[model samples]
Target: MNVDFVDSAAVQDLLDRASGVRTEGGDARIKAITRDLIEAVMRAIVKYDIDESEFWRAITFFQNGAPEFGLIAPGVGIEHFLDLYMDAKDADAGLTGGTPRTIEGPLYVEGAPLVEGEVNLTDDADDTGTLIMNGSVRGPDGEPVGNAIVHVWHANSKGFYSHFDPTGEQTPFNNRRRIRVDSDGRYSFRSRMPNGYSVPPGGATDRLMSTLGRHGNRPAHVHFFIEAPGYRTLTTQINFGDDPFAADDFAFGTREGLLPVPNRQGDSASIAFDFRLQRATTEKDEGFSSRTRATA
Candidate 1:
């Protein structure tokens, strides 16, 4: 007893009108994309026979999930899909190689204190859990990109990031730093070993994840935004290969080249990795994305 009226002229006209097909205002690209999205939604409503109760409940979930919507998008794999889509486009355009790009989670804050030499990512970290990570940045031809700026951030040992942590125990830029590479294209930092964290219990994202039979946990990881002159800015992160959830990241941040094993010795750990950047053809490729990010 499924009623299928999606192909009817009446429904088609409604979709066109909503996209403002007959109007003289609005951008054409936006209208076209909006129309397609609405059409898909309409089809889903009819195909699944979604009841008013279910529909309104979904709406209510989002209405109260303003703080979590951004996180939810990544948790559900949409953000990762964007990365994969862009990767395909780049490959098609003969633009490949260098460090792989991954989704930049929503926790990055602008204007971190820049340091000259070996930087300490966390100022008050204990010696027992100190992590010393070193890396070298090189261009595609294997030469050093000594002028690069390595932007790094990660959660504290308790798996809570500053600014976004609900407990408010962390100070501004508690585990964030902007380290300049040395003349040899090397950068190093000392930080507290970050912990794997989960979503807020009983929140909108958690509830939806539970409904989908998925766990909301990200492995111990560190984010990076590396940019140098004449090179494309790289947005990537490294997941500790030893973490249990490293391969099953909820944010889909883990990738082949980005997972590095941390060597634990005594009370501290050490890790090292190298990065390679693709040459930038335009000035836009050498800068960070204009996407809105947090500031502290």
Candidate 2:
């Protein structure tokens, strides 16, 4: 029997062979995940009757656009999907009554300059809309959680992030900083309102999105990575409700109770919100922070 074409049996045999290749340690976790993913992909190809040329084209696209995959995750809703999964696990473990966790976009950079209680994120001469965001960190029991570090970062007026922009390397951590809460768990910062941005034009992500009849545009928002001792880190964002794309975010990040109503006065605006953190029960969770834990 000469079987030259790729079929169910042939796919399974190939997958089995590929799964057998591993390091000297023979990591069970990686091997298992690889095998499972192979099976899923094989099933998709067979079910969809995906042609060889189309599949190879997709492979090429992914290979060239590997870096942009992080930015693409939100558009595909993978970040929100994981948030729902984590919420379910927390509920099962009796974790509740805290600030909601949201998607942490791909632009986070570690080692932002630390400040005591307040800092100005934008350059003094830069003219974007002035905004003052104030908040307090509290435990789930409603007690203040002092000394918590609130790392904040956002895009500039032109919808460009500090480290990811073309000239970003020069100013490395511009528009990004870390502020520790006061003794009463209060934290505040001065920054200009950031605007929404689209996927990089002429990039692999933009090309794929164009083919799909979709636009990769996120709403204006501020990113926050809050971490305190004795609590799990919370990675979230504050979406600006006034943006035209606020309710129609391509990333699906906008959610109920997450958008704050700003108070406008003269040239400055203010938003007051509170964050409640859940207690960490394990040693691994003790030093938890929203660093590289997120997939996207």
Candidate 3:
């Protein structure tokens, strides 16, 4: 019988040479890392007695699922990274807070109907109440922001938005309008005070929230997306004057400056508020639309 010894260095040299082979314009480092990861996964599959077909299926699932990770990043908490970075830059320049920023929800439609002065947003005939929202857009120096476009939308008195409510009518996107501020940077609108709304039952987002043991209810609030040339777009909400959730918004959008003092005179309710926008220096700071049109 003869004992044979293998040259470990020769095998290592072969591996080192194979690792240098380029794939998809990737260098040796990437190729080596890819090979190592593949080997580790294969070893895991063998050790765990995972089904070969299921293993490949899981790989396919992960290949498709990985992009969703980006949603959690820039679209979610990871966006705080950029926010913190910007805050640091502002702090260095001694720019303190004027208005707190909030997440821009995906529901915002582009290019909403533009109106002058005021418009009624309440939809149902049964809904009757005197609610007035008046505000002016301002600059950093507290100067009026002329010609500002203020987009306002909210749920109906029943806590149901138009597009989402199957029982609602067609025209007048319920509680949604784009009003151009006057030369004095003033705008007002009339609508019934909207009720607090819960997230739709049995949806992807709702399911996730339920699994996380979280309630998907947003406090009664009015949604506003204000924009003007040479200014940053401001997306925010003014909580209901007397809602219990005012201090406990599920979205964490409530800020000290966002709370509006309700001024009620007889049967009419009024909210006089002011918004300050950051001046835009670049072409990208122009503005964004506030409407959504469905495709046939």
Candidate 4:
């Protein structure tokens, strides 16, 4: 009688069989993605010879930490990874000349007031140095993209976000607003320089970061999601070059050309930034949807 013990090859074969087929209600795309992930996981399990107890413990950890995936993904560089992948794809497709994209974080809220051209972002008495961000929206060919919608939001000086913080309850969307570019493709806004923020100290996200010997700090920056007809939707952030964590963002979102050097004049700091969007060449590009919002 001949008997063969389980080996790495055997583990891989088992995973292939388990993940190759889609269940009754499982979508094809979901099945395909899970298959690849399951195969990689099997390889890790076999390579590390992870024991049942250890494997289950890790599973339980993730199960508990699932709610903090938004924080965890950025902290673990997964968000940046996706952006890099998209950037590579764009380069391959000759889609160039636009503001560099960055992670959107998890604090976006719907229904910020819509105003034409510009709007003030904050009215807090203690708001830090006033910020005036003015910019023009252009296409890859250097033509202005008129009527573009630019949605902007940022944390307060205390590193808290409107609609998601106790201090913001009194002023929902305090630092959030939507501005439309005029015929000249120009938009501007006034707000205080937002402070950098960190993950909640004892939250699941922070717990995992601690276990992994990592920090959860995001540098001071403002978020923008730009949309226009016949152009790719752009989601990006402008990092302050002078932030202490500018070069060491926990989310790995810092990038060259995305950092703006603020020009301090008198009591107000002003930054002149320009955005160039890629021409829409695909259905997804033509319909630039925000991850925070669903298409009607």
Least well predicted 10-residue stretch by lDDT in candidate 4: 1-10
Model 1: per-residue Cα lDDT over 184-295, one tens digit each: 8999898888888998899988998999999999999999999999999999999999999998999898999988989998657899999999999899999988888999
How would you encode candidate 3's per-residue C-alpha lDDT over 73-178 as one tens digit per residue? 3322444455556668768977665565554543444556788866776656534467898878888888898878988877776777666565655334767778
All candidates: CA RMSD (Å): 1.4, 3.7, 8.5, 3.6
Report the lDDT of model 2 for residue 236. Answer: 82
- In model 3, the runs with Cα more than 4 Å from the true position are 1-89, 92-94, 123-128, 168-172, 264-268, 289-296
Candidate 2 per-residue lDDT, tens place, 145-187, comes to 8869998898887888876777544266667888989999999
Rank by lDDT, highest first.
1, 4, 2, 3
lDDT of 2: 0.79
Estimate the lDDT of model 4.
Answer: 0.81
lDDT of 4 by residue, 27-141 (tens): 7787678778876776677667788999999899789888777788898889999999999998998777788988887777777878885679885654468889998999988
Q: Evaluate model 2: give its TM-score.
A: 0.89
Model 4 residue 83 distance off true place after TM-score fit, in angstroms: 0.9
Off by over 4 Å in 4: 1-13, 20-26, 123-125, 166-170, 265-268, 289-296
Superposition error at 13 for model 2 (Å): 3.5
Off by over 4 Å in 1: 1-4, 125-128
TM-score of candidate 1 relative to the true fold? 0.96
lDDT against the true structure, each candidate: 0.89, 0.79, 0.66, 0.81
